[model samples]
Target: MYTVSVMEDFIAQHYLTVPDPGPEGEVHSHHYEAELTLSGPELDEYDYLVDIETVEEVLAVVRARYEDALLNEQSKFAGHNPSVEHFAHVVWDLAADELDTDHLSTLTVTIWEDDDTWAAYEESV
Candidate 1:
């Protein structure tokens, strides 16, 4: 299978809402990195899994939507903790909605809250 990926980094703030969250319960900023991957067994006529420019365009909008924003206040995070795992799923939904997935078999969104901590959500297209 072939895969194409686009990534961007942004700063967003959120506070864990779960009980006994400790310091994480306080609003904090994380330098977040988001990566979106498209995969399929066959490439398009243009010899690409998906158009890189198109992916970049979608990623730009995704970046702008979250960059330097308060995740807790975002509608997508409404009633949900802005954890890395949830962030990945949210990003996946956003990107999937904007991209053409007819030719892809899988779409994956990975979110890195920091250098070492990260979470991912993958779906079949």
Candidate 2:
């Protein structure tokens, strides 16, 4: 299988809603880095698994919605913990809307909360 990936970075604020949580329960900001990967056995007419420019544009739209904002307030996480894993799923959902599922066979979204930690969500055909 062949894969293609695109990455982007953005900043956002959020707080976890875990019971008796620690410092993460308090609102804080993160310099988030998100990577989206698509894979398939074949490429499109352009000889590419997917268009990098299209991926970039979609990522930009996603970033614009969350950049410099409180994710917990504006996202479905309003009453839940906005963990890295959850954020990955959010990114996947957003990107899924833009991808051409007809050609792509797999999708993975990775979200880095910090230099040492990250989470990912994946879907396969």
Clashing pairs in 2: none
List the candidate 2 regions with Cα displacement exceeding 4 Å. none
lDDT of 2 by residue, 36-95 (tens): 999999987789888899999989987998899898887556666788898898889889
Residue-level lDDT tens digits of model 1 in 6-88: 88888989999998999999999999989998999998888888998999888888789999899999999999988999999
lDDT of 2: 0.88
lDDT of each: 0.92, 0.88
Question: What TM-score fits each model?
Answer: 0.97, 0.95
Candidate 1: the clashing residue pairs are: none
The window of 10 residues in a row where model 1 has the poorest summed lDDT is: 54-63
